[model samples]
Target: MTYQESHFFIWIAAAYLLGSVPTGLLLGKLYGIDVRRQGSGNIGATNLYRTVGRKVGVMTLVGDCLKGIAPVLLARQFGLSGEQIAWIGLAAFCGHVFSIFLKFKGGKGVATALGVFLALSPLAVLVALILFVLLMLKWRYVSLGSVCAAAVMPLAVALLSGGRTLTLVTFLIGLIVIVRHLENIRRLLAGTENKFKA
Candidate 1:
């Protein structure tokens, strides 16, 4: 590969590694627990809150969100093109979805994707966040709310930014988030999905 390609891959790898930090898992350990072994068995903030405490949950959320933001921002600072920035964001989201440190297991990519979108298309992310909050408040189901927001994110990005690259990245992130929620989907269908306990 040429030097440019190598540099591109390096940034992508860095982004993936940043996303693979397992913020929730590490936070759980600080409290002497394994987040992946408790509650919904997810390493995301919701599971952390349910298994640990609100503070730890919020901390993990911030850490994970930063994981998403840092990589894309750093790539942008490096003068990468918009397409490269989008790819880096997607790589970070993929890393959160399939963490190397977790033996290729990881959390659903909602929060991390949100962070990426925050950099790529702030207004679209804002709309999606509002939708998420409204859905959660109306239905008391975090998973449902996340899924709904994710469902709308691709169109939001497309319409708001008119950036095909970012829109494609958003669609992929949303698809991955939905796939990661397969068990939750089944539970929802059976009317057995756990409502947000907050």
Candidate 2:
């Protein structure tokens, strides 16, 4: 392959590897908890918070978000094209959703996707965040908020940034997020989903 092609693949691989880090699982281990075996059986921040502690959950959130941000920033620093960077962001989100380290199992890509869009288009992220917050405040269901925010992201990106590649990637990431929350959606519909506290 040519140098540019090779460089791009390397970055894609790196971003995926970074995204697959399983922040909640590692943090849970540090505290002698295996988050995957705990509440909701999820390695995402919400499960971490409910199963572990608030601090660990928050840490996981930041770490997963960074996994999304770092790769995009590095791609930009390396002078990658916007389309290439969009792909890299998607790679990062995919990693979190299908982590190699976790035998291809991973968490919902909410926080990580947030990081990606925050890097690609802060305005879109802002709009999504407002939606998330409003839903959270009104319904107290984290899953509902996440699903709704993710559902809104593609349109937000298209309208605010006008980057077709970025919008498509965001749409895919948002779709994945919604898919990963299928169980939660069922629970929400059944009125049995856990509500976030404080």
Candidate 3:
């Protein structure tokens, strides 16, 4: 393979590895808590915040966000194309969702996808964030907000970035987020999902 092709693979691998770091799980361990065995049994920031403490949860959120942002920024610094960067972002998101370090299981990929889209299309991310906040304020269901924001991301990217590759990647990431929240959706439908307490 050419040098560029080799570098692409290297970046993809690095992104995946970075994304698979399991930030919440690691933070929980530092506090003598196994996030996977607590709360909703999720290693995402929300679960960390719920089971651990707000500090650890915020730390996990920042760490996971960096998992998405770092690689995309590095790829851009290395002069990779937008399409290539999108794929790298997707790789990071996938690693979070299907973490190799966690027996191929992981969190719902919301914050990581937020980071990815923040890099790829900040306007889209802003729009989605607003929708998320609105939904959360109105319904108090984090999962519902996440699912709704994710469902809107593709359209937001399509309208703002106007790039087919970015839109497609965003669509895939959003789809995965919704899929990962399937249980939450069921609970929301049944009025059994927990609401965020602030």
Candidate 4:
């Protein structure tokens, strides 16, 4: 393999390791709390916010977002093509969804996926963010907004960038996010899903 080819695995490995850092759980541990047991048994930002605090939750969001953005940007800066960057992003997203350190259990990959798409197609990500915010404002259900925004991500990426590979990556990210929200879907159906409080 060429030098660049050899470094591909390095970048991917680095991304996965960085993404696998369970920011929420670590933060909760710092405060002597098991956030997973407190709220929704999730290690994502939302669960952190609900169980920990807004500050810790924001920190987790930033940390998780960086995990997604750092590797893809680094790969791109090293002159990797769109497809390679996409793979790097996917590796990071997968790390979040199935964290190695968490014994293959982790967050829903929402913030990490946000960071990935922000680096891949910022405009598309911005549009999806707007959709997510609007939905959240209207329904107060972060899960519903996440599911719908993920569902819209591929269309946004396609329309804004016309990137076949990026669209494919976004679609897969969306699918994983939706699947992760299956429990929320069940709760929504049963009218037992929690709503965000002002």
Error of 3 at 188 (Å): 0.4
Candidate 2, residue 198: the lDDT equals: 67
User: Between 1 and 3, whose TM-score is larger?
Assistant: 3
Of candidates 4 and 1, the better by lDDT: 4
What overall lDDT, based on C-alpha atoms, would model 4 receive against the true structure?
Answer: 0.91
**Shift in Å, residue 179, candidate 2:** 0.4
Model 4 C-alpha RMSD to native: 1.1
* Model 2 per-residue lDDT tens digits across residues 1-198: 999999899999999999999999999999999988898899999999988989988999999999999999989998999999999999999999999999999999999998998899999999999999999999899999999999999998999998788888988998999999999999999999989996
Better of 2 and 4 by TM-score: 2
Tens digits of per-residue lDDT, candidate 4, 1-198, equal 899888888888888888899988999999999888989989989999988889998999998999899999988888998888998999999999999998999999999999998899999888989999998888899999999989999999899987788888889999999999999999989999999864
- Of candidate 3, the 10-residue stretch with the lowest lDDT total is 49-58
Full-model lDDT for every candidate: 0.90, 0.94, 0.93, 0.91
- Sort the candidates on TM-score, descending order: 2, 3, 1, 4
| TM-score of each candidate structure, all chains considered together | 0.97, 0.98, 0.98, 0.96
The TM-score between candidate 1 and the true structure equals 0.97
Q: Which candidate has the top score in lDDT? A: 2
Q: Model 3, 14-65: lDDT tens per residue?
A: 9998899899998899999998889999999999988898899899999999
Per-residue CA lDDT of model 1 for 62-153, tens digit only, reads: 88898899899989998999999999999999898899998989999888987898888999988989999998888899999888889999
Model 1, residue 139: C-alpha shift (Å): 0.8
Candidate 1 Cα lDDT to native = 0.90
Q: Give the C-alpha miss distance for residue 160 in model 1, angstroms.
A: 0.5
